[model samples]
Target: MSQQTGSLISCTFVCLLLAFFAGQSLPVEGANILGVFTSHSPSHLIIHMSAMKALAEAGHNVTVVCTSVPKVTHKSIKQIVIPLTEEEEKQLNAGMTGMAKEKPSIINTFKNLLGSLSMYIDKQVDVLEDKRFTDLYKNKDNKFDAVVFGFFFNYYQVGLGSLFNCPLILSWTSAPMSIVDESVGNPELIALVPSMNVAVKPGQAMNFKQRLANYFGTTLFRFIGFYLETKNVVFYDRLWGKIPDMISYDEAKKNVSLALCNSHAISEGPVRPNVPAVIEIGGIQIKEKPDPLPQDMQEFLDNAKNGAILLSLGSNLKSENVKPESVEKIFETLSKLKQRVIWKWDDLKHTPGKSANILYKSWLPQDDILAHPNIKLFITHAGKGGVAESLYHAKPMLALPVFADQPNNADKLVQSGYGIRVDLLTLEADEFKASIKELLQNPIYTKNVQAFSKLYRDRPMSARESVVYWVNYVLRHHGAAHMQSPLVHMNFIAASNLDVYAFLAFVLFIASLISFVVLRFCYRKCCGGKGKPQKSSQKSKVKKH
Candidate 1:
């Protein structure tokens, strides 16, 4: 009995020793994350949520502070929803409605920013002051490894990352722009890379005029962004300035660990330059296998004998906002198409006069619907997220661009021969119908887009995978400060080497002045000395003669 007891004790000791070693070898616990996505646009929210959902799936604890409730969320993620007030909702809708009527140009778009930006800023400040978001910091025990923010011209929100003393990960919904680039110390690249609001053809060279327009458009918009940021400085100081050991807003701005942009340079062109810190997860929102469509939608799509067309103006569209006449024209045009149509109208009770072939849904699974085999053309507002999905699904698009990047996105789409673009505000029945028929009849658009889709999906890792890895990487490396470009910390004078150039110029100027003075003094001294002797000697010679 004693020997048996001794053997059991020895075995237990061995097992305990092995367990300790195994525990040491196992991976550490997942990091805690905070997501701040306060963009007024719902499409921007979709991209931000997709990225946060990825982090949660990778075993991290993610807490999101967003203005609107997300349609799709992960079990592991918790949300602190702060919806806009009824007044704010009206203002946002009104702003979008007013914007849709304007002729879509980079100038006109930015020309309208000042009036609408304040509303967006007011919305952000309101979200910051909310008790639910404040409680995260009020309770001292709350800790986060990183704070991911959706970049909607809100630089002040970087203070939250500062308040948490964690990495600030910025999320941009389009390709690199001066606005996004300036945050992470990326070069302006204005010569080659057009602003997100200005679209250039994928592979086409920019003419002098195009380049000139890009330069001015980029500068003016950047100034517009800077102006808006300056206005938000007060809000930033009010909320985050008082915390002890708090990093300054300016410091936090330069310290952004990285940015994840929803753009693929390979598929979407003007191949500029990028720093290591900028990660392009262009089609991050696209699912590898799209979710199953609604039974009715599935049936509708399955029954599409002639290919189908999808029309979505994105989250901002409202029946009341769309001019009735324009609606009549659009309806008259779409109602006559041979292809079946699925219109994502906001109001189901009173849609744009539905036809037998048209299916109206208040809400749509856009990505899933695009992935359907029968979807031949996507008529969209050309928002980055929608364009990315359509491109991923290899569906050609007809863009009725209204404002922001839509006009630019439309121009780029047309250049790629993917589809045509028409002004939504001035769309005529004949033109709209002709554009649709052209895309449907042309095999070139379909062929070009399909080939591009192959390249888009050929990434070494998927966008979701990229998000998980990079977020963890930032956590592991303590903000990945080394990957940051030196430009982030540099002022314009220092970054442009203007200071060095000025110093060199001063030195050269001083040297040149000294040389000129010395030469002048020596010449005068030698001439004066020699002249006096010659005059005196000639006078003496004249007296002797």
Candidate 2:
């Protein structure tokens, strides 16, 4: 009896020990994470908030700082809303409208989207003053394991890192621009990687002209990128000025732990190198399984035996903004098609006009609709989110890009053999109709996109799983200081090793100068000495005679 009792005690002790270690790990797994997602666009918000949603589902206590309410939410997530006032709203819209009307280039696109110093910076600086947001850092008792900033070339968000004393994770909405690469010191080699505004086939090399354009684009990109972030130094300092354990803007940026980008390098073109600190989690905004379609729309797609087209201009560019004639061209082409149409129109009551073959809904589940087998083609503005969805579902696109990155995305679409791009501003009904017919008739579009779909979805871990693992990784490892890049710490001279080259050049110059002087001295001495000896011999001979 005593032997049995002792054995039971041993087992109990072992079980209790294991429980202690398990309990110790729970805090790391269920971290208190703070997320700042203050970009103004609705689509951009969805992409960033999706990361927070993943954290909440993983049992983290996620508190988000955002401009508007996020479409993605979780029970464990709490949001602090600091919406823009009416005046700021007008300023932001005016900035967007002004940029859209400007000339098109990679630099202009940068300013159009994430940049334009005055628009994004001034608005974000205002966030620093909002009491609701300031309260997070002001309180001494509050703590967070990490701070995930929905990045947009703005540096003031770095203040969250200092305030919370945690690892910083950046959530970028699209592929790396030169500025995005600067965040984690990820290299953006223009030779190997095309500009974000430029697209090539998945594994193709650039031609001479492409390389030349890329060089110019990359230089301007770096300048604009540096200007955009460096311009925010005043606000960054002001926000963290009096706080304890304050760090300089430069130091704060260097300490950033990771950048979770919304792009798949392999599936998307311009495949490039990445540091350990950078990860691609594109299509995280897409649902795992599509929700059921609403009744009328369900029947509409159900009976689309000839297949159907899904059209959306994205949330940022409204239907009203579209030229009335362009809208007419789109409607005219779509109405005449044998295929059915599901258009995302903002005004249901005042749609362009009635059509027997078209069903217009003010709001639609974009990805879910794309997932349907009946969805033959997607006509979009080529926004990042829409592109990800279409790629995920293997649906070809008829791109009618308006502004910002849409044109670049359109370039990628045609380049991939999946779709064609037309000028939305000058769309003709004949051209629009012909492009749709070409995509439908051509089985290559379907085959090519379908093949890429496999590459896109074939990942070691799903996007959400990666988000959970990495976020927990940072928390458990205490700010993940080891994951930082050496480049982040280096000055421009050091990063490029320009000083090393300069020293080598100086050494070569000194060595050459010494060799030249020594040769000249030796030549003069030998020649002059030989002539003197000959002259002396002649004098001696004459004297002897």
Q: What C-alpha lDDT, on a 0 to 100 scale, does residue 509 get in candidate 1?
A: 100
Q: What would the per-residue lDDT of candidate 2 be over residues 42-98, giving only the tens digit for each residue?
A: 899899888889889888889998888877788788989889889876666666556
Q: Please give the RMSD of candidate 2 to the true structure.
A: 3.3
Best candidate, lDDT-wise?
1
lDDT of each: 0.86, 0.83
Model 1 segments beyond 4 Å from truth? 1-29, 517-545
Q: Write the per-residue lDDT of candidate 1 for residues 1-545, one digit (tens) a residue.
A: 69999999999999999999997555434899999988777888899999999888888899999988897689989999998989888987887788877888877777666676457766787788889988998898999999999988677887877788889999988887776888889888767787655567787668788888888877788688778777668878888778788887778778789899988897788787899889999988899999999999999999999989999989866766777888899889889887889998887888878598899998899999999999999999888889889988999999988887888888888888888998889888899988888899989999989988998999888999889888878887889898999999899999999999999999999999999999999988977678988999999999999
Query: Worst 10-residue stretch by lDDT in candidate 1?
Result: 22-31
User: Per-prediction TM-score, please?
Assistant: 0.91, 0.91
